[model samples]
Target: MVHKEVADHIRSWRFIVLLALIVLTFITSMYVSLRNIKPAVSNISDPDHLFLYLKLLTTTDNTIPPFHVFISFLGPLLGISLGFDAINAEKNNGTLIRLMAQPVYRDNLLLSKFTGAMVIIATLFISLCLLMLGGGLLLTGVRIEPQELLRIATFIVFTIVYVSFWLALAILLSIQFKQAATSALTAIGVWLFFTVFYPIVVNLVIRAFLPDPSFLSRDEIAGYNEMILNILRVAPGQLYADATTTLLMPSVRSLGPLTMEQLAGAIPTPLPFKESLLIVWPQVSGLLAATVVCFAFSYYLFMRREIRS
Candidate 1:
């Protein structure tokens, strides 16, 4: 019974649409990145656009092209959308009672739901990443080695963690709201607040509170600017970005000098993978724990609620 429910959920049209969207976005990103490469410098007869491309790719941010930024923002939103009604919808359809009457344990239902959603997320995330890797190899003609593969694997795992955070939030909302639509809307609202509006609000507050003094020189103005930014670093986006930098970048001599340009320049290092893991292990674990906590709270609400027709 549990397996059937999971399979039916996975086979829904929503899953197909989500999968298609993921692939389309992934392809678009690769196409744009490859198409936008500047002409290579003339040198010896042997020209390596692939190596030059990857090197240049990580060395700087694309001011005109912002696909990477979109991925970072959209990944979590996708997770939340998929999960916002995992439970509430079943309840609404009068299927929850039917399922609970089966031989399967109550625990199996919840576990299978989470597992199914995760399977979908993982599939799309890995597919997009592999597409990026395949495109890189095709353009550069460079063979991927064990180390490079390791970096990609770690990055994919991080993406899963990031998405899981939003999924957990969705589950919590679904349990709190009886209606699926309301749960979804609430989840999206929270997503926008944290991912979009919250940062803008923080910036406005910072500007209002710490305005640049008209009397100050350029250096003083820079100091004031840095002060405001440092204060804003307390925001969730800043913390997540910091954790991502520590995980993805090879070396970080100082976090103080971080700017948009600096982050773009910071590429994955060839350092011991475990060392990078140790640095960001806390963040990775913290996010996963938060996800678990959110779901646990949902479980409490869900188990205690009275179901009615």
Candidate 2:
């Protein structure tokens, strides 16, 4: 069943289009980063060029944003496209009922859809990372450090989990809505809300609450800023951005606003791989929890759903 689903997705036009968009964005972003590679390396003082490879992915030129930024914005689209019709399409074509009539368990059927989609997503991300590494080395003539390569590997893993959250959400919508079009539009609507409008709305709300920051004390203003930052982190996009920033930019020591005391003796240096992972562990856990919740709810609903049609 997983094999059949994988083959079907490979042949699907939706998959083809999404894959093309990712590839185009990735190549464009890498090209932009490569153009600025000289500045990126020269600005740093590390003898080993510890993050030369990471700079390739995170540094941006005038034309395009960083590769991680592109993934943060568009990765959910791939998940939604792959999963928005997973169950409803099967039911719409009458194949779902036929498949259920076989000896296969319902658990197996739903699990197959998610597993197949994940396999495809993982393969796409791995290939893109390798492509960026090869291009970065060839274009810049720099060697990647062992730690830097580990950070890239970690980023790819985080990306997979981040995207899987959306995939699960889309599948849950598919389970809830009988029409594929309905599920697809609803998923995209949610994505747009989080990706584009959510930040605007958050800022507006914060402004309404603190219209006169000048009236507040310094500590009060700092508190308000921290509060606003926390509110923004409610969006998955923000969480992914924070996590990826910490991973890709070794100089990022903390995700939150730092006090003067905390920065008093701080040196400007990249963090070790272990410390970077520690900083982003909460964000990673949140993403994983959200993904599991969506999938579990979808599984429950799918099992209880009536399939007369």
Q: Estimate each model's TM-score.
A: 0.76, 0.95
User: What value does the lDDT take at residue 141 in candidate 2?
Assistant: 78
Against the true structure, candidate 2 has what lDDT? 0.89
Instruction: Please report how far candidate 1 places residue 189 from its true position, in Å.
Output: 0.3
- The digit string of per-residue lDDT tens for model 2 on 1-309 reads 889989999999989998999999988887787787778778756432457888888777667788898898789999999899999998999998898888999899999999999999999999999988888777767777898889999999999999999999999999999999999999999999988899999999778878587788767777788888888888899989999999888888998777777789988887888998999998999999999999999999999999877
Q: 147 in model 1: Cα distance from truth in Å? A: 3.3
User: What lDDT, from 0 to 1, does candidate 1 have?
Assistant: 0.65
Residue range with the least summed lDDT across 10 consecutive positions in model 2:
43-52
Q: Give the per-residue lDDT digits (tens) of candidate 1, residues 77-159.
A: 67777678888888998988888877966667777777777877887778777777777778867676564566567767877
The reply for model 2, stretches above 4 Å from the true place, is 45-50
